[model samples]
Target: MTTFQKVNRYKKIIQDYINKHPEKNSDDVLKHLLLRHIPLNKDSEQSLQALSKFRTTINPFFRELVKTLKNPEKNIIEVLDIYLKANPIKKNDDFFALLVAYFNSFEDLYTNKDLQNNTALYQQVIVPLHLYRERMEKDKVDLACELLERRPVLKYEDRDLNAINFMSPDYRRISSEYYENQRIKDSVRKDHRLACEMIRTMAIPKKELGRVITDLLKKIDSDDSLVYLIFETLGSLPIPKDQQSIVVTKLLEKVQNSKNRSDSEAAVKALIKIPIPKQQGEQVAGILLENIYSGTYDFRSLVPKLASIEGQLERVVTHAIETASKSKPSSRIFDNSPEYTTHRLACESLKILAGLPILTESLRERAVDVFLILAGYSDQQMYRPALEAFREMTIPESRHEKVVNKLLENVDSKDGIYCSYSCQALAVPTVFEGYHEKIINKLMEKIRDPNGKNIIYFCVALASMPLLEHQHDEVSNRLFELVDTKNSDDFGYTVQQAFRALLKMADSNEEYEKVAAKILEKLDSGDYRVKCSVCNVLRGAVLPERFHVRVVTKLLELIDGKDYTVMNNVCETLGKFPIPTSLVEQVVSKLLPCVDITSGHHSIDKCACEALGNISIPEHQHEVVFNKLYDRIDTFKGSFPQSVKPDACEAIGKINFNALQCPVIFYKLFMRVMNPDNVFETLNRDNMILNTLSALYNKMTPTERINIVARLESMQDDVASKQPNRLPFLLSVIQKCQSINAFSAGLLSHLPAEKAEDVRSGMVR
Candidate 1:
């Protein structure tokens, strides 16, 4: 008979038996057919066609085979052995796909204790895998990765080693025995690549794998891509610290010699991933800094990476400051000298370093001196960088007075730009401890001088400080004179600064009344900037309770004007009022539409949320406000602007669940906290969720708390394994409960042993 006819005849016989024994399951049918010694007719096109048709009729049988292989109690080795021996699936057979599926499911099998202990069974599985590996065309590399990942510690028996040798295309040395053959010298590159892929995919114990990886690193030549891949794999292994330092040093050398930008970037990246010893920290920092100055590559991207090293921060900070301090003005006016260019680069670097979260006392002192000199320089371009560096520095308490005095001295100088920069710097509240009065007097003296063309600078300086109650009257009157007498349009920046300062001094009812009247007068100004300034000043004024009605009336009128900036400012001002219950509906009705608009204007939405949160504080209004915020959160899940969601979360957190008289509120928030799909991953959102849970925890009854805690305990394993931070965050929420309960005990017991003990000790205290 022909091959197709022969296979069809077999199918007919199996179909007849299945029909006769209809009560038998698919497994029984598969075993019966396998026991009959059905021929696969290996590699025949006709047999392949027939088998494809036959597999469709026996689909259930293949599924049953998969289930058996996955069952932990079954001897997987024996099952695979029987199936491979009986069926003898060829590369072209229809059963090959099913077998591949079976291989893919072996991840869980690797975790089985029986498979780990049975060395003989390991031999049985590897025999067929080696055959399959050799036959695989498209998925050969993938199958290799899977095999390594599944059995990373698979013993290298002679048969297994022979299989690896046979699979390599470059293995050309002929010998009577596989182990006796010498590998071709030209195959070293291919061998190294294969070794890296093996090491990367396998979970070989670090002690055994580390040496292999290090030796591979040594054998590779100047092939950047190969070196990069090997370095990445090395990063994953727990190599000894001393060995890691050696790898870091070699990578640094590679970075120095690499002319290819991509290669250099990759080398630097790998170097940073391995922690450098404290003694070697400066060398790494110096090399990276030198690379940055050479301009061969975009080393600016490496600033954050460099800053992450433990001991590199001080050195980087010192180098940048020293470079910037050496800057001097060009001898020829307006000519950009080489020194000027170098100084500019240094100052830019200093700004980046200052922005880093790590700032030592010595570095801060150095930064202060460099910035002060830069600010005092004649070049206007240097002022902004200097001011930025100054703002970022954590000035020591002992140096605060000296720094403030130096800035004040610059403010008294004839250089208008320098004076303004100094004034702005002194505006930081902590800079003027006892010197507030002295600085404010100096600014007022400058503002009072009719010759003071820099009155705008002095106005901004005064506005930046926190005005005390006793000095309010004088500061306010002088600021008012500047805003009214001076044409605000001519110096709009100055007018805004002066008006903002005047409103800040309005602490009492009389002062607020006076400031409100002045702002109301300016609200009619033709200049849009003046109107914007008036709206901004109104935001800061503490209107009296009686004046709230009038203030709200004026703000509502402005809200009708439809200028987004003015309306946004108005919404923020309206939220600050402790409105009477009679006005809640009017206030909420006006604000809700603004919040509901999804036009991507986050500021307006943010202000509306804040206003709604403020008005929703009344006991009777909690449920209505809660539903509104909840619906907004639901409507815009992932597409919402960053600020809107956190604002909504915070607003929802402010609701009084007890006052709402709805027990479901607690459950709803609890579910929202636990739903991983719904949670935003940002730190702000996570913190807001934690805050919301803390709020709900305080209100939850013991039964409700237990339910929540039980859910947390159930999810603890998945969460702890995926995101370790979440466990501590959830524990923090539980800690906020009014009192501990049995739920707490159950939750604690689910934590890892050390963490659970720490939590137990904390609870006792």
Candidate 2:
């Protein structure tokens, strides 16, 4: 069959099950249904369709499938993944059984005796052998060998070792055990599988693993593998609690004798994980730092993890960074990850340790040279890293204010934006105060410098401008000029953002008028998104007497527009207020048409429901919205995406508190909101529904608030601790209780002393 017809035939089979079973998640059933089709080409739409179809489903089965299959020579994994993804429970009964069924019928081949040879079926068939080997029994393996007609040997050293992907910690040990039992030498034989297996074995038992690795480290030639193994083992294994000094001793020996670059790095890393007593560990760390200090060991990959170590790691990290400054960054330790991210994380870590004294004058000079060398690297986050580390190492803002002032003096064009970012980072409000003028001047020049050719520089430069502002006019003038830019390419988003920054600095009408005018002008702009953007900005603006008339005129006009999104933003923004009786009906009419129609876009739908929340005053419109949400509740069986359903609850959250006649419906809607649905598969996406959920809970009574919190707490055992949001819900309860207690306390304080005492005593009684 053609790939298309064959896939359609399989999809039909899955869909028929969905129609028949209905109980299985739509995604899982579909995966099992689609397993017959395979060799999905990258260019083929089959992958896209399958992903798109199943992305709607909410199970970890697909991720497991991806993990199950990633082999160099295999297509059956994809088929098996889909089958199990569609039928996890069915397949979970026995992965071996599932695999046996999958390979047992190679339909068209039809060689009865070829199938009879269990060895050929298990080994040559290519699908079930590896996965089954990981989990299967000795008896099952014999049966598999009988059917396939070849021994299914999964141990790397015993088979085509080069073909195997790197195994896990368990599988790695398995390979190592197999090799040792056969009396094979890893060095002369060159078995990658055995090497990987040994590496993984080290992760679980560091002292024992460290001892074995010391032997292997003597012979290992590949620095990369040795280093990673050493790093992983150190990173994962616990140091022997009773004999910590032994681990330190082994690591010191490993780093001293280690010829491979990564092996040396691993030895360094493993040393950090060892629990040397503070005074003793400090001495041991000093020794490791001396080796790195002496320029004996090389570190390429373990630098970050090394930098991340506590106690003596600082000495090691500082020494290595210092060493890198002298030696050319031998493509060994040069990392290309985001500079600011690495810098920020490292600084935070250093900051937590009293301070970073390692960044002294000699260190600073070397760091500067390293930054200059690294400037040519392609990754943008690099410069920020250096600046942050420099920021830490440089004397504290209190001690080195003069140094920053001196640096600010060199703010000329010679040093460039990299220097400028570094200087500004050093001079931040907490860091430097007197150099604000020089810093701002440099920022404006960089921001306006068309040839400066740096977007991130300008973006960060502008974002940082308001951080420590003494003068407002120059800042406002600079911001205003950008806002009124006639250039079409100047998408108002950035400048509008700068205006928000300005709002944070502004206090009076004069400041508000200039800011509000810029925002209003954008709202009236021809671009649809700009208009929506304008509404969002204006909604957040302070409603002063001067700006209110202008903002209201455009807002009312926006409410009358056909772009549903703009209208939604307008009505939603307006709903936050006490609606004038006259405009209440107009807003209601604007929202009525959106009542139960699933908005093609979520934002427009959000705006519509938010606006409706103010006044569902019209009777029929109220019934339409309530019933529409009521009917749609069951539309998503188990795997419904919560975004669509969250809105339904949000719309109810608003209407429930407003003038809706159905208190019973509101109560039921609140209960449904409290229930955990499969639609909310992941909590990573911020659903506006939580905003609605919180708002609905707030509008509720003490009993209702308790009801919501109680329901939220029940999901804790089932949901991943990181995934479910318990903090916000718990805070809301505490906040409500505090407010109520404070008000009661204030009222009781007003009574006569005797009566107050009696009241207090009565409470105790």
Local distance difference test, each candidate: 0.59, 0.47
- Give me the runs in candidate 2 sitting further than 4 Å from their true place: 1-378, 384-395, 398-427, 441-475, 501-507, 532-536, 539-553, 563-602, 606-642, 647-765
Best model per TM-score:
1
**Candidate 2 lDDT (Cα, 0 to 1):** 0.47
Worst 10 residues of 2 by lDDT: 104-113
TM-score of each: 0.50, 0.40
Model 1: which residue pairs collide? none
In angstroms, the error of model 1 at 324 is 2.3
Q: How close is candidate 1 to the true structure, as a TM-score?
A: 0.50
